[model samples]
Target: MTATNVETTRVVRTSWLPLIVVVLTQIQASFAVNALTVSMAGITTDLDTPATSVGTAITAGTFGMAAFILLGAKIGSRFGTRGVFQIAVVIHGLAMLGVALSVSPTMLFIAQASSGAVIALIAPALTVFIATNYHGEQQGKAIGLLAAAIPAAGVLALLLAGWFANTIGWRWSFVLMVGLALINLLLSFRLKRVPAQPGLSIDWAGAILAAIAVILLSFGFSGLATWGVVLATPQAPFEVLGISPAPILIIAGLIVGQAFFMWLRRRAHEGLPRIFDLRVLATGSERAVTACMATMLFVGTAANFLIPLYIQVVQGRSSIETSFAIIPYTLSIFLSSTFVAYLYGRFAPRVLATAGFVVVASALTLLAFTVRGEWSQAFVVAGLILLGLGQGAIVALVFNTLLSAAPKQLAGDVGAWRGLVHNLSGSVGIAVASAFAVGILASSIATSAAEHPEISDELIAQVNLDEVNFITNEALAELLATRASGPELDAAIAVNAEARLHALKISLLSLAAISLLAIVPATRMPRQRAGDLPEKLEPDDDDLIDPVDEQEALG
Candidate 1:
């Protein structure tokens, strides 16, 4: 290109409208997930299903997205981002309607899973679009806004779902998602399109292998709260060497996950089409971004799940109350995310990301100590502020790093990787937190019962303390109502309360330890300040490879 053409391209002002539309996609995706958490009680009651079943719907969404996100990248590369995004938006809208109209648990599963699949097609489109359309400071700002929008949408979803579930119904929360997707679909018409790679081929073998690994891992994680993690529980259909089947599934997933990497290597050396480009993660900087993304997501998802759980299950409060409790935390995330991106200019990723991890760990530790049966909201809010400040800043920095490092052509691959990281981490985080909390609850109850004669062994045996169960005080009272009476029953109830509080504190401490461990990886991040020019990947010549022939190779 001549200097004149380069000057022309540089001078062209990117429209903010397109960025807004792309950000909407980010917002809508996060909103659906957060809304489901706050709406859990209403959905389960309406469908006459167990609470775990309602939670599974969320897990199923993550599985569906993880399974197809890589393929979504291939589809986008073949069909064009703009076309796929528009069509995906339409499909998402219809799926949201199915979700809202679900009459049974079975229907809810189908609707949520379908919605997740369609979302995979659109999720990658937004990041790729932003990375392709904007550059330099503008690109940095766009990535910041996208990160902020997720939490912002989360706040909106919680508030809306709370209000709707209290007044209209939980179903309307989904109806709102349909409306948002439709609006985005209309706005997407104005987006700039890339010419499709007509001969693009899908790596079906690698795709299937990766998908199964993700699905098994995700399912195992989700079941931790229902099925025992190590020892066999009643819920397990069978046991291996007297161990719970949940851990077995997780072990299988890890082996399959290794198999996926091996297959990718074999394909690369054997001259087959690679599903995931190894080059995207060739640098330490890119890997740092991935590490930071997973760590922050795990902390964030675990915290988010715990908040609603405490308000609804422990405190016996309504969904609206859960939203009210989340305001301080969600608000902090939104506000901090808006300003955090500006820090990139002055601070290195190593410094910023490490500091972010520290803040999160400290906040989690604070919650662990301060939380009680009758918690003080003021202390929780203070901790949330600290958590949000760190989380918001790190998300922007890591995202901007990836965008600036890679060339425009690899935008689809970058998005696919992001979707995979987020979905997997989120599923794992929620599952592990739930499992940890429930495990503690059962153990604490057993220990207290064994020591205190008032809460006798006979009384403990009446309840299924061997299984994973996170129930409200009300539920405990109701369960004991039929089986016990007098001071013994009352003592048992007191023990349950103490056990519940102890479980929450211990589980939060565990999460804090994980967040602190993330500091080790964060230290390896690039020391370059955000203002420095990134080593950009030069785009490959698109005309060199045609997908029509198997022998035609990608440079």
Candidate 2:
């Protein structure tokens, strides 16, 4: 076809229907996780399990996505993007149904895990569909919308799941997801079909290695609080000699991760099909973009986790209260994600990304000083709004840059790598934040107790300070009720309150420091405007050459 014909074909094929379908698919995946978070109290009450069980379920879901996302991308190419997406959506809905019907913590953990694994299939296909169906600016806007769906779903889950848990039950939240999944599956028919590359071979060995590495890292970080950060605790299931299994698993994960990369280089040398496309990260700019993406996600996810912990645990507030308190932040993220595309043509990626990190650092510093006792304070609200704006812009900008850097044929790999980084970084962010905050809190409590004249060292010996976590003043009083009375009880509660607040402030400041450090990577992002990037491959051109064959020829 002539250039004019290709232009005409592109316009004719571009429809908002595909964007809507993919965005809804993203919303479905995001809503499931958010709903679980919002329904934590109800799930704990109904299942008669500790809150940590729900946390385990969340970690399990993260592990599932991180471990299988690379493989999921390969699966999408071997079959067809649309077909695999449809099947995955159906399976995810079934997993949600299982979540709704779960009677025990184990059931909930398995169901959420299944949902996450299936999302690995859906995530990559969303990017491939946009690449196949849109061009130029339209493609940029589509990616922004895709990024927006995440916080939009969070807002929806907070409102809907909170209301459902309060009135009917938490189960209704996932039931609603099942209904939406059905609608999304119906809408899947409208998406453009990308032909399957049946000749593409699966690298089962690399897939296993990647899966093992992700699982080890996820589990190791997640278990730090329970299994002990450096040494074995009484709660640890097993220990290596006297050391905690957590650190051992983390070290092993790093070794295996290095091996996975070496194996990929070998595959490239031999001209064999690999699990992921290394070309996506071949350039310095591309590597910098990846760093920027991971840093933004780590800071954003950590802030998100810390705020809720403070709201619900420190202040002894309800889920509904916590949800409403975060509305400004979530809404700001939605607005920024949707409108940031307009600025892409005016500014280079490096400029936008650097500015974004600076804003985030400033917001975190403000939050560290402003947050005292309440979530409704004006300064806290301002900080959250600022944080959301910076985070939303960076998330959208890096994604657009990474996608634009690669050929349309490698979109699946780009999408896969993005998914892996998003989940893994978020998991580590929460883990580190939890461990750091609790460690500080524990140390503060011990020092305060030692200094207080009313408390005795013998009393401290009776209680295990190492097992302490973030809890409300009321819960702390109940725990010490039998051991101490009158001024002693009062002093312990006072110590707990002051220590928790101090720990929170320190944590926010530390996160702010990390955000400031991220500016270095943002400065190295691509210097070109989005419009200056190469035009997207035409639809007919996409089907003409296989990505595997193209890689071999390029080598």
Q: Compare the candidates by lDDT and give the number of the best one.
A: 2
* lDDT (tens digit, per residue) of candidate 1 on 141-193: 77678778888888898799988988899999988888998899888887777
Per-candidate clashes come to 1, 0
Q: How well does candidate 1 match the true structure in TM-score terms?
A: 0.90
Tens-digit lDDT string for candidate 2 (1-555): 899999987666677888999889999999877777777777876997655556667777877898999999888867888899999999999999999999999899899889888899889888777777777768777878889999999999889988888789999999999999999999998776778876778888999999999989987887787788999889788998888888999999999999999999999788777787687787667788899988888888778877877877788777777788888898898888888877877887888999999999999999999998887789999999999999998888888777766555566677788899998887788777887888898999999989999887777888787798877788778888889989888988899999999999999999999989988878777644234222222122124323323232222
* lDDT against true structure, model 2: 0.82
Most TM-score-accurate candidate: 2
What's the CA error at residue 550 for candidate 2, in Å?
A: 21
Root-mean-square deviation of Cα positions for candidate 1 versus the true structure, in angstroms = 5.2
